[model samples]
Target: MGNSPRPGLWALEKSTDYGKSFKPWMYFSDSTHIKDISIGGRCMCNGHADTCDPADPNADSNILYDAGVDEKHQSLDIYGRYEGGGVCQNCQHNTEGINCNKCQPTFYRPSGKRWDEIDVCQQESGRCECRKEFNPPNCDSCAYGYFDYPNCKPCTCNLNGTEGQHCTPTDGICPCKYNYAGQSCEICEDGYYSAQCKNCNCDTSGTEPSICDDVTGQCICKLLHGGTRAGACVRALRVRPRRLDRRQLLGRRQVQLPHQLWRQAVQPPNFDSVKCDRCREQFYNYPACEECNCDPRGVVASFAGCGSVPAGELCQCKDRVQGRICNDCKPLFWNMQEYNPYGCEECRCHLAGTLGGLGACDTRSGQCECKSHVGARTCDQCRDGFYRLQGDNVFGCTRDCDKQSGQCRCHSRVEGRRCDRPIRAHYVPTLHQYQFELEDGVTQSGPVRYRNNEDTFPGYSWKGYVLFSMLQNEVINVVQIPKSSLYRLVLKYMNPLPDNVRATVIITPESVVDIQQK
Candidate 1:
């Protein structure tokens, strides 16, 4: 009923037409049926149908082809033809199939190449394994105190012991230590010595041996003359002396004896004497004769030599004219007025005339100038009709008389240049006429007259001595007389004699006449 089957594997209609059609292939239970139906004896019903050839089963064939077959199925039947089943399954390049298990020289694999594989990559060495002359690891770094070399070796020594490599030490190069001397410790000369060889003797002459072997001790000596030598003595030529005299050197035997020396040589006594150049003055001995003796009234002790005295010499006054030998005042004299020894006594004079001009009384001539209105040789007191005023030296006269009136210009109470009068009570007299006698034997009279019932009289009452004999029980009153009256003043007093009274009197200066009343 169905069309006879094709050979090899049956193809779906879609596979035969490259999937363009949809007819499905048939499958049979026996190959006899397929061979009887198709011209090829091969059957198409079995899976080996692809191995069957249409021409001949025994003929060489390109079995890989099937029209419209899938690419995956193309190689599916070739497994038995190659050495390994699949393309690489049992080939030499197949890692699992071969016994070649080692990895390539330069290549490495962390996982095993085979069941017991070994890793083949090289391991790195650490920095410590590098050489000293070069830097670690790669030999690229240089060591301490060295520099890198072109060949990778480090440059070793610093040159000339200076800055570069290969350096060496030289002479005259080291610094000297404290207290040491020498170009190179040559023998220690005069002052110096020691180990770093520095030290000195430091003596006055610089000739002394070093005390502490020139190292430890310093020079010590007397000031100025001192040095390292402890007890060194200075020469006598350095001493200085003050005085030089042959007479002063009695004990020294250095000089030859003089001719007069042996004659009086037992013991030349030391003489201490002073001589006077003028009559009684004296001087201390010999060469530097300085001091002198002076007289009681002389002044030579102050002056040094005879030549120092002035010419026309005398033991004179210490000052100009003061002392004895013309040294003191002559006779009854005083030295009041002038200065110095030349001063002489003063002359006596009145205070008013001399106080401003001459100072004191003149002892040489006892004369003095009289003050105005005063007339004594010494001018010690005031004259008649004048009086001494307030001060000791001042004087004044009674006021002048007024000739026309015969009355004083000033009343008796006022007695100076000015007529300023003192006031007092008026006097009244009982008698018509009265005679008055003064103690000094002077007398005056006046007619007792009345002026306004009060008797007016001359005001000449002064205190002095008056001698008058009074008659028993007869009281008498004496009063002043005015200059205008014509009565004669009596030197004696006579009372009207309640019967007859008479008294006798004597007046002075031998001039004023007495009036005898009847």
Candidate 2:
């Protein structure tokens, strides 16, 4: 309508009966501008096409008068901005649409492809294009065991040391196995060793703490220290006795007394009073002087700077110290100190709970060699969930127990925390007696005989008593208490040698409340 070449007339709809009836009114006309227009058909294709067929269903059956139209005027001719619609014939660049602007089947427009480009729609190749270690097709995900897409690489993981084959996607670090660690599970965690990755039980003081040979699990001991646990100074440093050459001993202080001086000499010219000008606390023995350097902390205070022998033989050391300089601790002791009279504290490790059932402990820290499940500085007690520390038991305690209750599994006939004794039976379901035969439980130290005398008439179920000579005087019995409660002890003995015989009764390892009778 804006491009019409001739002027036209137009009118507005007028109604007087409330829009019930209408007629054309208010006529207007324009000569320079198009006031009104009408057309038979028009082309609506975009710039991708230059012609439209009026017979096509997508285009309008309208005809227009323009200076650029052909003489026949059967079809519209325009590059873009066509008003009529029609399917663009022989679409360009494999494109197909009402305006010839979209890609056809089996083809796709590459990202950022311009619509005006001749080859904007590329044909599908039926193949995936992906970077290395990335999944095919869309390439939006990483391949198995690979991560960090667009720059993907194989997962660096140690199959034996990692918990799983894959690693964390973002960082590419695998979850480490027990006692194993690293970004790629390449090394063992601290205080662990070997391909198996076991804990490094290095001595606390004798060896460097929390470190050992990675492959062999051997402890690296401190200076002058070595043992099963590297807990002691294996060799003692002893002072060599000083010896004098015959000529030096004879001529150095020898003097053939002159006849006049010999008559006045009383006690060998008082050799003790002789003193050398160069002699000091550190150097002694005059002509053959040597350094008297002794450890002040481990040696006697008065002998810290001097010794009687040229080689410091008389450097008196404090207790548990035995060296020329008194610098090293004695075996089974550790941590030398000035104020300590014994020079070092003893390694008082519990034999039962310590590693290998040894009393050796760390020299610097004095920490005992503890078993896997033992604790405390002395390693005397079992950790929670265990009990009954026996030296022969490698793990330091019995692990089969109720951790919360400290109760052991029992047999059908036994009932106790330790399952040590037979259960008491109730004959009438109302009364019961908890008793044990002495002959069956008591451990005797000598040849003891068990006999029964029914004529004594103690009870119908009385078993027997043990008899032994006076040489065998001690007996042992082990009992496990069922619960925490007060208990009474009773003892019986026979006095065959009746000279107003007196007997003493004793119980071992007194508990919270202790009592004895004689």
Candidate with the greatest lDDT versus the true structure: 2
Per-residue C-alpha lDDT of model 1 across residues 369-488, encoded as one tens digit per residue:
344655464555557655442224534232245436545466565543455445466343434366453432322343222222112223334333233333222223444445434544
C-alpha lDDT score of every prediction, in listed order: 0.35, 0.61
What's model 1's lDDT at 93?
A: 23
lDDT at position 13, candidate 1: 36
TM agreement with the true structure for every prediction: 0.16, 0.24
User: Which window of ten consecutive residues has the lowest lDDT sum in model 2?
Assistant: 262-271
Candidate 2 structure quality by residue, lDDT tens digits, 322-372: 676788876567898998888998888898897766666555677777889
Candidate 1, residue 122: Cα displacement in angstroms equals: 99
